[model samples]
Target chain A: MQKKSWNWNRFLACSEENMRNLQLQKLLERNSMSRSIEIERERETDGTKGCCKMEKGSSGYISEFLGSIPTFLRRCLFQVLSFGPIPHHIAFILDGNRRYARIHHLEAGMGHRYGFLALLSILKYCYELGVKYVTIYAFSIDNFKRKPDELQYLMDLILEKLEVVLSEENMVKQYGVKIDFLGNLKLFPEPIRKAAEKVMAATAQNNGTVLLVCVAYTSTDDIVHAIQGLYKEKQARIQQTAEGKQMGDDDEPVECSGGSNLEEFSVSSADLERHMYFAGYPDPDILIRSGGETRLSNFILWQSTFCLLNNPKALWPDISLWHLVWAILQYQRVRPFFEKKKRL
Target chain B: MGANRNGDDVTEINRIHLVGFFPNDLFQITSSWRLDIWNLVIRLCWFLLHQVFNTVHIMMGIKRVLESYFVPSGLLDEYKDLQLKKLRYLAVVVDSEEALQTLRIIKLLQWLSAIGVKHVSLYDMQGVLNKNKETILRSLSNSRLWEESHEKATFLNGGKMTLEFLSISDGREGIAKAASYLCSKYMKAKTLSGNQNERVFTESDVDIALKAVGCGGPEPDLLLIYGPARCHLGFPAWRMRYTELVHMGTLKSMKYGAVVKAIHKFLTVRQNYGK
Candidate 1:
């Protein structure tokens, strides 16, 4: 909301005087290629069916000033920001799309397209800012309760986006971003599931930032899955002898009364974490839910115990660079307390 | 014009007056000072935003109190308001999971009881509320304590309030125990069935097992957190699927109108229950 909309002119104007080419090493060229999502907001006025905009989208969230800013100044700003702590992982709960559409008087379902566009734009900013992981609550398991027609449209849109990500021209391939389709992928239709799998496999070898797209996912389901995964992992390692003893990794597989003697296995805090959907990644330092709502809606509950939760008054489609920066500054402020908690 | 004037002032302030002291290291010194200035500016913005949020929160509290005042006397204590009629279950999440706030807990329960909240769940990560559940329950009048270990129903002033106590144990740790129990059951089932093929349990499978073991419960309609932190404080994930979480500051500074306002807002929100 406008709560965080303090004038950035001081920071911006001050940059001009101090804007000597400090880091002239290599300026990142703005890729002129077609963006993965191009929201044709004007097309919404013509009563067109709500769908993905294949062409470049010039939405309100994607500031032209941000993209067209001199590369050195952008770099200088980030250079200064990098001095303070930058969150290693950031998560987003994209809410308020339908509300945004209603406020703007858009056609039904166009709000989600704008939400997706904002997500891509935000993802680019996060990755560029050196965040190693960015997870989005794309579709929830409860979303299956929506009308059948809306569900079909959503599935189709997701399938198309997955196909785009698999292509060589998309941002995923360009950035070498590893994409993870978390949640119960088994719930999606056959075609959508297949597309999701294909995209995941295609980006499996990427080494850049990781984008976790949670489809049909709930935090409860994730925790249950983590427990199941942990059980399997431990089952392979621990022996099922009369006495419950931890087995070495290289030990021979021993068979016993598997069922009767398995009750002693309990996960320490560490074991469950390694088996979580976000294993090998740090917990998010900040989780922003844009939609003027202050609810998690059953999102990353386990991973966000200490994460700074920012419920900006901005809708999902209206989230811009300033919101992200403000969230980062807030994270920097409270990071010490969370660090102490983690240590304890 | 005002913004431009301020920008000019900032630019002037950005320059260094004592640069001759370190002529060779002036660039390094200048850049460092500029970075510091930028950091201060951003932090100042954040500080102002927090203040704005506080003001909005205080105003919301005032508005709620004023609304209750307009209602007929004893109507709110009776909770005859049509808005809160649909609120079946309410959860109070406190951030202070370590040190027990006995009086605060009692006062909150009494506040909830006055509002005619039938079903209330108290959650803190450290079992502080759960440990003091009996002490808190004893203070209420005509409170018919429920038969369940964690549940209590109090009938006061013709309005009944049911209370459920929860902590971290009832959340992930409870699930962890159930998971181990399920894994053991699955392993034994496979052994008895003589099936070498691995069996992967789904989310529903865990849900069923949890129910069989009496682990999970129905999701609450609203969760009001009493803390500086906006998180659920590890209140069981299984039960908060559709719950609307509202932060009402710390329990020490808790207000009756804030709770009323939170409920009023929750009732007005367009809840599209997908399932």
Candidate 2:
């Protein structure tokens, strides 16, 4: 009986070894399968098709087929969003570029490069969604408070990017975008001011979209500027009136003249409106501030009265297409209220 | 039969030789397999944890929404003890969409009264509140919360609340009127002084002009916005130059907690008006 039991145990051990060997072979097969899938994904991202065949086996073929589905689905979603109610004007307060750099351990000024890329992507998306006007708070008047070196870097970056936008045929020529620098141009260096003028002049007749870059701008300053203009205009009118009175010294008062023409010399709201920096453009429909800050930071104060403010937590450079879509969705929900107010 | 056994032995030897040639490959394959299994287990655990977390979050969100629907008990008492600066003048700017709900406006006023806010300015973009001013005043007066002093009866009773209804027409138009008044005043002063080169107009001149025309209101210490957006919705710009704006979300979902939070936030903030 003991001998029979020993023989049975030996048989059990042999079967266990065979099972282990089978498991090893299965694992090897799965490893190769995953490796091929990784290679296929890389090939698809690279946009090089024939190079995918350089990988030995047909294992990646299935993954290559599956990877295309996501791209296809994304394209479909984009098309659907394009058909939705698009905001006519979108304002962006691009915040947190430096913070993003600090978090990522990137070199100083490298974040602005990434920020520029993000801006380009956003512009493309906005244009695709048929946004007519985009006002970006590129550089605030308070930004000059930064360290001199940092400010210099920012100025250089702005100049470099502005040059690119001017010379890049695909961007300006293809889109026919009108670029307007809305701020105190006198504060800028002569070269930058001249360059901005050249760009504005170049795109003066472009009828596609309007892009307003608020450089060295603050709402307080804009208001003060408008007030000064109104003050000057009022002074000019007073002088003209005095001169007219002097010239008509002996003429009798025209009794039949319209009373409306002799109305009091109070400045009208139209005078202030006409002198505003954004005189021609309609008020921004939506003001988006990234980095989760709630304050307006003195941006477009007069025009933001009826604007929908959307503050997404993502840093400016980290903002995604979904953030924009979500904002538009919120706008769509509140659009009826806006229309109702208009009608009333 | 012996020849057949030898052939089988040779095949076994070849298989062993292949394994020996790539020892690291076998080890790597087994390790990777272990890693894959470990990854699957981790992923499953994470998914389950995420689902549970998401459900809890949704439940909390629902609870908060429900809580906001009703004003919490003792909120007024708690607000009394709050360490805040004297908020003498309070301005509430409601979105036009919310202005249609008279009940909500009344409730907001009642809530403000409970919080011991004596002076309040109610603003709406389309002048809806201004249009319904009589009804709102009547409701407040009739309610037990407000007491009217018969001696000096005005739209706002002297007891606990003094309410002002404002609209967009009162904002920019008022400023323009004030500016016109100031211009005329400056011209008269200039003509009287007969000093064309001298600076006749000062900041105080503009202030006096605005006051003389009764075009400007006392600037609110804190401006609370109850709306779908964070914007002031064209609140009188002249009156809100230094006002601390606190967006309290939509009026439909107004919460006592949020109101207290806004006041607390206002108290903690330090404003530097171009110092």
- Top DockQ: which candidate number? 1
Give per-residue CA lDDT, model 2, range A93-133, as digits (tens): 88878888787666687667667667766765676456889
**Poorly placed runs, candidate 1 (over 4 Å):** A1-84, A102-105, A168-176, A189-191, A230-255, A258-260, A267-270, B1-85, B97-99, B144-160, B195-204, B211-215
Q: Write the per-residue lDDT of candidate 2 for residues B36-102, one digit (tens) a residue.
A: 4643443354344335545764696577665444425554453446563367678999987788999
* CA lDDT of each prediction against the hidden true structure: 0.67, 0.67
Candidate 2 lDDT for residue A306: 71
In model 2 chain A, where is the ten-residue run with the lowest total lDDT?
A: A254-263
TM-score of every prediction relative to native: 0.71, 0.66
Q: Deviation in angstroms for B120 in model 2?
A: 3.3
Per model, the share of native interface contacts recovered reads: 0.39, 0.24
Predicted candidate 1, C-alpha RMSD: 11.1
* Residue pairs of candidate 1 with colliding backbone atoms: A38-A56, A38-A57, A39-A57, A145-B274, A259-B188, B118-B162
In the range A33-80, model 1's lDDT, one tens digit per residue, is: 233312332343232223223343676236545754654454445443
TM-score of chain A of 1: 0.73
